[model samples]
Each structure stands twice: as structure tokens, then as C-alpha cells.
Target: MKANKETKRLFVGGLGQAISETDLQIQFSRFGEVSDVEIITRKDDQGNPQKIFAYINIKVAEEDLKKCMSVLNKTKWKGGTLQIQLAKESFLHRLAQEREEAKSKKEKSTTGNTNVSEKMGGIDFQMKAVPGTEVPGHKNWVVSKFGRVLPVLHLKNQHKRKISFVICFSE
Candidate 1:
């Protein structure tokens, strides 16, 4: 990934299961000012453990991302391998993608339910959202809210459909 004045963080994925944040910092700190490290985890199709992924935030000039990646790529940690690259886009981009996926899933489920109910004559599925929650409207919201936040919000499966909204302050 191309790194420049606009980029300050990189996402490191395909990590060995045993690697930790401290280990990442130790390995990556040599290039420049290392700020934060985060590991991404999720279950596989069979619900088995999966390789860990991470996002590393650096506090140096953007020019350093390449140097850092060069030093980190093909490096080994905790008996496992490492894949480092400048994070693509911002955290909001990820969140927006997740929201779209959830929306599509919901639509498909509704369609399937309708077809089944027509055939079985007695099947119903209800989905509801709690009160006072803001459902995300568009992908831009993610970029607006999390683009600058170093540790972008983790858009897990559960929060995808809840919508994006902010609580306004009243004086």
C-alpha cells in the first residue's frame, strides 16, 4: 500500500496465533515512533481458532510507513509469520462495508422468510431494534467519526444494523 502524508497507521494481518501487541511493538518500534497495536480475532467457518490480525498506529512522518513495512514484512514472531501493510482507508470504511453486508443479509433473510411462510402456512420471524439507538445512515458517517481516531471503532457483526447516530448535546 502507498503511504504518504495522509497515512499514519498500518494494518498487520496473517499473524501467528501466539503473537501479542508487545511483541509487535518490539519488532516495529525500530523504524519510527510506534503508537499503538491492536489484534483482530474472529472464528472461522467451523468455529475454530483463526490467525490473528492487527492494526499498528505510528506517530511519525508518513514517509516512514514504507520503511516500517520493509522491516516488518517476512519477519517472524512467536514461531509464526507476519504480513504488514499500510491500512487501507480508515476504520469507517470497514464499518460501512460491514453495515452494507448486514443490510443485504437482512434483506435476504426477509425474502427467504416470506417464501417459506408462503409454503409452510405457519412461520414467522421478527426482527427489532432497541429504542434510542442510531442506525448508521451511510458509509460516510464512519469516515467522519472514526477517520481521525487512531484506534478506529471495531465494527463487529452485532453493531452493523443498529444504524449510525450521535447523541446531541443540549444547553
Candidate 2:
């Protein structure tokens, strides 16, 4: 699959069971700034392993990504030929996107509740503050009100001179 412009995650296939995430990270680090690596595996009830692959996220230029894929793809390592390509959107991420879209459509259909609060990904909470309310230490306030804070977005209306905050909670 083609790489999304906003993401630099790569899918690496044909990995031997012996290869670890660190091994892949170290090898790919030479091409770019490796951010995350995960080696996928499935084991049977008897503890015998099956299905081996990996996903690696690297922050690199477009040219560097091409270089990396070209140089490493089909190379023999750890008794398997490496198959490197741009990673597709993860299953969890896709599910979240679909849920978010559904929620958005539902919201548009019904318009009664003034409260603007939503739960995203079953963990993160998005809370919108009432317009024209000033919150001091917004980040700290969110942390104290909620268990943990992920991101706080402040939206201001120029015409109305009103301010609002969209706080996303981690917990």
C-alpha cells in the first residue's frame, strides 16, 4: 500500500521468528529517525510460534524512505528475505476513525444537548468549555478535573470575541 503523506510507518514482512523489535529498529535507524518498532507474532497452544512480521515508524524525508525501502527490500536477513513497504492504517486506528465519523453523523442528526462532550477511542474524552468562560491554567485545570490530560485546544471567535477550549483527556 502507498504511504500516507502524514505518516512514515512501514510494514516489514518475511521476518524470522528469531528477529526482535530491537534488531529491526537498529537496522532501520541508519536510514532515518526510528520512532517505534513492533514485531508481530502468533503462537500456538503448544508454544510453537507462527506468523512473523513487523511494523516500524521512522521520521524521514520522502527521499530517505525510498532509499530505505530500496536498499532493505528483498535483502536476506535472519534466514528470511525482508519485504519492506509503507504500512497501511492500523486496524485500531481505522476503527477509531469509523467510530468518530459515526459519532459526527449522529451529532449532526440530533441537535438538542448543548453540552459538548465526547468519548473518543473509549478512553480519551473531549470536553468543550462554554463560550466566554476564561479558565486559568487550562492544562492544569483539565488535569485536576479529569484524571489525565492529553491535549488542550483553545478556539477563539474573532467576530464574537469569544474563547472556548476543547480539552482531550487521556484517562
Candidate 3:
């Protein structure tokens, strides 16, 4: 029996944050064989972690892809809604190109500023304190602070050091 195009592998996208590869495989497996699954992540301006999306590839006839879409489109998973559709060859190609472009952009930004600059609201500090000095603590500071107290290193075996502190703040 010849395989139907509908049963061929199709790509699914617009995944929610809580969706996992295993969840996708299990969910889609009910309709057809899931060949592969991938979740995408990206960082925001503040260097915070963020989930971009996900893709699922199911092995089924072409008609099955449509069926899958109809069944799964606008579905909710783990409190997140999804946008499912048949992935055309051109769509996959476009995704690959976009990924490459994103990678290149990241590389360029790392090597040199790529005009993707964002203002950082706060500052970071590394301080070395004397033995007797007490670091003043601030309340309700504009920026969040994280500090570590460490033994200060002695220079030329001269003076005794108390602590070395490192602090970071976010505005």
C-alpha cells in the first residue's frame, strides 16, 4: 500500500512553555508517529531566559497532517495555547534560514555591538574592605542587590583584610 501524503511527517509549531518533547511525542503519537520534536529558546534584552517556540514532526499521510492540525490547532496544553499547522517544505526552509540568521546575528553581537543595545538599569560592584570597616546595608534600594562576603587577600603580607564583597543589582 502506498503511503498517503497526509500521513507524511508534518511540523507543528506555536508550543507553550510547559510543553515538553515527551508530551508532544505522546500527544501526537495518538494521531500518528512523531518522528522528532524540538523546543526553541531565546534570551531577552535583560539576558533572561525565554522560550521561543517548539516544533513537532509526525510521520503520517498528508491527509493525516490536516487531520492533526484540525484536531490540535488552538489547543491548550499546560495552560498555554498552541497554533498548530501543516509544515510545508518552504516553511522548514524558512525556519532553517531564520535560525542561521539568528546564529549569525548572535555571533556578530558577541564579537562586536550589533546595534542591539539596551540600557541596564543598575550596576555591579566588587569591593575590598578593611578589617574593621562594616559595610552599610541599605533598605528598599532602587536596584536589587546580591552580596557575598569573602576573606580579603593580603598584599605584601602587610595588613589583615576582613572581607571581599561582590554585588549585583537589577533595576
Candidate 4:
């Protein structure tokens, strides 16, 4: 996929399973400032071994990155031909997108409870603040997939209700 404009992190796939982060970082440092390198590892249950992939965060000057990518793409490292490109939107960014989609779906599903609170930890909470009421209405009420209304403890006047985290079930 084409890199987003602000993307400076490179995704290094086709990595030899034995390759380490330090080796990857050292190899890519020649192109620009190597700010960070992350190697993701997950336990392969069937294989019973760690499967690894790497992401490198480089801080090359804006124009220099294109040059770096042009020269380094398809280069070999650690016994594997490298397939590199700018990293996609991060996990947190993806979470925000999910939250927005959930919010829109929630609005359509309910009586247009169009009062979701600002994002906290990339999660948009339910907002029950009435327009003119002296007491804050509710915060973070949970609604279930099967239409079970679980009331979470949103402590302002301390509504004594236990609720599950609200989420949109429809895709």
C-alpha cells in the first residue's frame, strides 16, 4: 500500500525468523536516524515457537525517506529478501476509527443518544449530560448486543447500576 504522508515507520516483512531487532536497526540506520525498532513476536500455538516481524521507526528528513526507500526496497538481509514499506496506521489509530464507527452505529441504533463523551484511551464513552439539567445524566452506560441494557457505575451522582462496556455489535 502507498505510505501515508506522515508515515515514517517502515514495516519489514519476510524477515528471517531468527533475525533480531538490533540487526534490523543496524542495517537500516545507514539511510537516516533510526529512532526506534520494534520486533513483534507472538507464540505460535501449533508450532510452539515465536513468530516475529519487525517495524522500524526512522526519522529521515522528509525528502530523504523517498530516496532511502527507493534504494533499500527489495534489498536482502538475514538470508531473506526484504519487503519494506511505510507502516500502516498504528493500533491506537485503528482503535479510534473503531470508536467512531461504534459511535455512529450507536446513534442509529438507539433513540439517537448522540452524546458520546470525548475520547479517553481511544474509547468514546456514553454521555448522559442533559442540556439544561443541574445533575449530570450519565457517563459510560453499557448496552449489550442482544439489547440488554447494562448500567455501568458512572459516578457523578453515583447511579447504583452495574453495566458492561457499551459497544456496537453491527458491522
Candidate 5:
């Protein structure tokens, strides 16, 4: 995605304590119109402020933004390798995206009998069953299917002809 269309804010890292907002604006204005520059700082243990990083809001063409990021990222400036990246989307945007994903997953889950895999946080949960098995509600077949992953299995909704379970795995 293009930086100009997605976002104009850029996260800048590895800035020195001596650098100022105007200095950052001067360095970034070579490629585009820098609308604003913010140098973030935090107090150290000794009660002295230290420069952590900065954010730059620039208006530029798509190609210019790409070139600017390439030229500035990892470049040595003020005795530190600069790390430049497109800042993350706002919290509202992330929440909206998550809600949309949940809606789609809910829709997919309401369909016919099939295997479904879901990832939440750092855990993997897979719901599956052997369709062509002769014996109904066989736990050995289910365990054998996921033996490679060393799963922690939880069986539920058992019946004469069908068995549903959840298999969890950690990476």
C-alpha cells in the first residue's frame, strides 16, 4: 500500500538526545512537505530527559514516500541507525477490523459440517472429525489425526454416529 494513501505519519527511532523537532523537519523536508514533527522524550532514572524517537507527518507523492523511507531507514544519523516505518493505524480502525473479522468468522462457522481452524492470541484451536470412519465417536482416530502436534484434546458433543472435539496446540 502507498504511504500517502494509507497514512502520512511515520515512526522514527534511534534518535539522539541532541536532535530537535526542527532538525527532523529539516532532514525529512528534502523529499516532501513536512507538515509536523514531534520528538518524543522520557525521563531517565537520573531525572534527566532522554530522546527516544520522533514522528513525522509529511505530505508527499507515493513514489517519493517510498524513496524517502528507503533512504532514511537504517541510515546513520546523530550517531544512531535510524529506524523509519509507517505508524500503525488508529485504535478505532483496529477495533473495526477485528469486529469485521469476527463477523466473517461467525458467518463461516454457521455453515455445514466441516473442519475449522481458529487462531487466537498465541493458541491454535482446530475442530475436525473423520468423516468416513466405520466406528462412531472414536477417540483414537481423533488423537491419531493430531498426534504430530502433541495436542491437548477436549471432546464434546458426542453421539452415536458423530463426535465433535477441540484440539489445542502451542507453538
Candidate 6:
């Protein structure tokens, strides 16, 4: 027995790697206006990624999902079963997490907590960010994950190749 709140996003799991975001967006369009299709993946210890699952966001309210949930759930898609659930928690978590982070950041700023970049005057390179190339002359800085600051090279990303964004840093 689900509640009557109208949520636009839905969690779609039990996905196969073969499914593309466009494929999902097209398939889900039959129910309502598909806003975005996000496929969440998992990374191995070696840093290689593997597909885990996906999510579909519709433009209409939860009533749209309620109308189409039965038809899409457990349906065979790309030779795999698709599981769909309302993304009520997704919305709630996003709001709650933002509030929590803002509070934490405020506390850190008030206490004069200095970051690594402030002392070192350079950026921390994670496994995926830094490219094997010279730094660019333009751009001031690049923000890292978890709102960390880093002065970095200007990166060029290709938008035409596919839906995935690929940024290439060059000399």
C-alpha cells in the first residue's frame, strides 16, 4: 500500500549493462514525459566500472507512475527484468543531505578550518581527475568532489560523442 504523494522520479533496477540511457528514455516515454534517465554504476577495486542499475525521471507527478508502475515493473527489457519503485526517498534524501552539508560547511568556516590546498597552494589529484598532460593557461580553479578546492588545468570535454561527458586535459 503506497502513499498518494505525487513523485516524478522512479528507481529502476535489475538492469543489464547493454541498456542505454536513450533506450530507457524511449521505453519509459510511453508512460509519461521522460525528463532524464540515469544509470548508476559500480566501480571495482581496480577502478574499472560495471553497470549496477538505473533510474528514470518523469515530468508528470506520481500519479503517472502509479498508472504505469504495474505495466513497467517486472517487464522484460533488453532481455532483463526491470524493477520500478517510486523515488520518494530520493527527493527527501537530496533535501536533507543538502541541509546537513550546509550546516557542516558553516561550522567548518566559522572555526577557521583550513583545507590542504590553502597550505599547499596546489590541487589534490584523485585517480580519475588528473590527465597526463600540461596545465592550461586559462581558468581559475576546478572544484573537486565533496566541495574541495583545487587550482587545475583547463579540460575540454566532448559533448557530441555520447551522453557521457568526457573531459580531456591537454597542453
Best model number under TM-score: 2
Tens-place lDDT per residue, model 3, 54-167, is 666666776666676788888877756677765565555665675577557655664345332112222222234333333345221222122222233323424664443324
lDDT of 4 at 79: 67
Clashing pairs in 2: none
Instruction: Tell me the whole-model lDDT of each prediction, alpha carbons only.
Output: 0.59, 0.69, 0.55, 0.62, 0.65, 0.64
Give the per-residue lDDT of model 5 (tens digit) for 1-171.
555432388899988778888889999998888988878888789978765788788888878888998999999898667999988655656656765785577667744633323222222322243332322333332233422222333454546455444454543
CA shift of 141, model 2, Å: 37
Listed in order, each prediction's TM-score against the native is 0.46, 0.52, 0.44, 0.50, 0.48, 0.46
- Poorly placed runs, candidate 5 (over 4 Å): 1-7, 90-171
Look at candidate 1 and give me any clashing residue pairs: 134-163, 135-162, 135-163, 135-164, 136-163, 136-164
**Candidate 6 C-alpha lDDT tens digits along 1-171:** 754543377888878778899998888887678877889988799877655688777776466666688788998888678888876557556756865775576557633566554344444343335443222332444444434334553444575442323243433
Candidate 4 positional error at 143, Å: 7.3
Better of 3 and 4 by lDDT: 4
lDDT of candidate 6 at residue 45, scale 0 to 100: 90
| Candidate 4 C-alpha lDDT tens digits along 1-171 | 533334377887777777887898788787677878888766676765455678888877656677877776788767667788888868766767766887677566645433333222223323432222222244444444332233454333358764443334443
Clashing pairs in 5: none
The alpha-carbon deviation from the true structure for residue 55 of candidate 3, after best TM-score superposition, in angstroms, is 2.0
Residue range 1-171, candidate 1, lDDT tens digits: 644343267778778777788988887777666778878888899987676788887765555666777776878767666787777766566668766775576467754465422343322222333333223332221222322101123333675654434433222
Off by over 4 Å in 1: 1-7, 92-171
State model 4's lDDT: 0.62
